[model samples]
Target: MALCLLSPGQGSQSPDMLARLAADPATAGTLATLAPLAGDEALRVAADPARCFANRHAQPLLCLYALAVGAALSAEGVEAALVAGYSVGELAAYGLAGALPAAAVLRAAAARAQAMDDCAPADSGMLAVRGVAIGEIEALAAAHGVDVAICNGDEHAVLAGPQCALDALATTLAAQRGAHVVSLPIGVPAHSRWLQPAVAPFAATLAALPWQRGALPVLAGVSAEPVRAPERAVETLSRQLAATIDWARVLDVAVEMGTTVFFEVGPGNALARMARERHPGLPARALADFASVAGAAAWLRRQLA
Candidate 1:
């Protein structure tokens, strides 16, 4: 049996997330180091639900949360056979795997958010569609001029574009039997072509950061491929900014690679839930489900055993 560590993206942060992590001794120091990197106003922003969901605040905070949990897990002597991050969480995965320093991941996340913000259209956003076929989703997105941002599976995908277009698409999809559509909290069109302008600048930011070989492999969100070298990491990381994320492929690759258990090292259990829904029978849990890191580690030990 093998363990795969997962880190969540935006839409996973909670108002009391910082407070919860602060109460954990194993993660406190890491949070302290990450809080400032997120911003001088990070703590305040985290406390306010309105501000925390903004791309500028959400990106760094999510990365910080993931890094803190990752550090806590490592302190407990838990090692991952693989690591995969969703959207912004990809940066934290690198930090957890030792490709970059924890501090550097926060910086990169901040820069990435800024880059995305620079190109984001005023009314752009994302919408999640479930219980629908990919072909229908693509056709609807094409008709509405939106783009498929992330493919979670054949029946689940995220679309991004103007708010009005997303609303139209959602209306159409919601009318269908067994279809569910929900607007995501993320304000920017993350993996859509609308984010193309953000790529070059973010690439420069990542290229400037110091990198080293990680202890474990990380699955690239843009593709289901393993990233072992710095150049590959840089390419996939920056390219994914405006490219479609094949998250379904990531999960399939993880299972094929012998991932018997999945652990989400962040505030919410969304990633874990997705893993369970997609692969049924695979054990998956999130850090937020446990009262302490040690408890999570113990659970992981049992699952792995």
Candidate 2:
């Protein structure tokens, strides 16, 4: 196993989804321990699934979900050499990589969410644009006031800006060329300048909080590389507000490191799907469902056999 990459973060929570893990004593105990910070609402939101789509709720819940699943895998003697996370998932990545405690992760997540919510504007939102060339999207963004917030792949991306700009882009994408556009459930425009207001406060929170050097190599969503310093944590955390997310780079880097298996440790399988999209040759699977975990584990055992 050259690298067993574990991804933790938002947009993966589903209702009744974690019940299987909760039933497993090894997994449930860790989850039970996090109840105070995470709360029963995490399960309720996971059951609904859509609730996890909200940034305010998703941020912290995903942290707990990531910690729980990552903890379970470690309990099973599975070890990952490198770990990376996207957006809010970065905190969970930190915990799984032993850069922070589960409590600290949740606390940071909660504080971050509150800070983001407090600073986020009411009209701003994000949009997912698919099946378009990056150059075309880049050109479009330049033409409009929008920014390329997330580059999931060379062809797939998300543009963020004011509602008017996003709506105009949506029309343009459909009218000029055939492109799929969907409004992301997230309200605040993430990874765009629209979040500039939240950066400082969130950074201050991170700076005040104690963060240790990571035990395992931890890749950052801000630059798609390993973040090595405690101070860099605050900088990266703050950059999330005004930076573009290069998820494609994240996946490519892991593959280059000989990452044969990717475990998306959370309630949803979004990152795993992205892994398959970005690297079809490599095996990428989610640890969302127990059956999925068992299947991936068995496959890995065969590969490592």
Candidate 3:
């Protein structure tokens, strides 16, 4: 069976997210390699939601977690022919696909997070809205000075703008029937017009970096198309910072590409849940759901067989 690896973005992090992986001896080397990038007392930082929620800490930590999990699975001979990531997770996807080395991937992730954080105002944040039509959400966003950051599907999306505006939108949506809005812990208005200032610098940084073609195809988060060239990869990644992501389409592209089995190599099961919701028949599981890397690998091997 052809397998697709899914890397998750922000909003799924928790205090004990990486405890199981950290306890595994096989992940020692991978954790060591990522420790410096994750900062002093990395696990301590991860255990604190307030500190880890910052863009500076969250980006690198998420990338490290995904890379470590993927490495452990690979060691067990779980093969994924295709890969995709959501937002910041794309950097980890590049590393998983062999498009960037470990050092380079962490460096890029740090830089990307810093750049986006710089563009984000202290009062700006994101909100996830569901059970409301995209058109209605767009209308609300236009009325509230917020922008649609991501279109998860026809009736679900994430909005980004000033925190006050999001609060106002939430209040308004609360009044409407069948409308739901949840404020995300993140403070940055990522993937929105507010981050437009960060695009040029991030693109320049990617261009200056030494890049190698990846061994596996990575579906672009913005377009869901297979990106084989480093140039295209850089462009898509940079542009996505200020563009709305169509994640539903990305899932469709994965199925169209013959992905029968899926693995989410990250701290949470958000990606896997989304995939299963979109395609109930597809076999999808998250590494975080397993008690050990070996258990996850065995499950994958069973699916392939």
Candidate No. with top TM-score: 1
C-alpha lDDT score of every prediction, in listed order: 0.91, 0.77, 0.87
C-alpha lDDT (0 to 100) for residue 31 of candidate 1: 84
Q: Largest lDDT belongs to which candidate?
A: 1
lDDT score at residue 68, model 1, on the 0-100 scale: 88
Superposed model 1: Cα runs more than 4 Å off: none
Q: Give TM per candidate.
A: 0.97, 0.91, 0.96
The Cα error of candidate 1 at residue 151, in Å, is 0.7
Clash list (residue pairs), candidate 1: none
TM-score, candidate number 1: 0.97
Please give, for residues 1-305, the per-residue lDDT of candidate 2 as tens digits.
65455565444556665676787666788877885687557777756655757777778877887888788777666778788888888867878888788888888888878877786677878888888998899899879898998888888988878888888999999788899998877777788887788888888878876577747777777677777687777798688777998888988887777788777787767888888888887777776544645565565566544
1-305: candidate 3 lDDT, tens digit per residue? 89999998888888887666678776767787777776777788888877888788888888889888888888899878899999989878988888887777778888999999888888999999989888989998999999999888888889999999999899888786458889998889999998999999999988877788746888888899998799999999999999988899898999999999989998889899889988889999998788778888999999998
Write the residue-wise lDDT of candidate 1 on 77-196 in tens digits: 788999999999988899988899977998999999999999999999999999888988999899999999999998999999999999988988998646799999988999999999
In Å, residue 4's CA in model 3 sits off its true spot by: 0.8
Indicate the TM-score of model 2.
0.91
Runs in model 2 lying further than 4 Å from the true structure:
48-51, 289-295
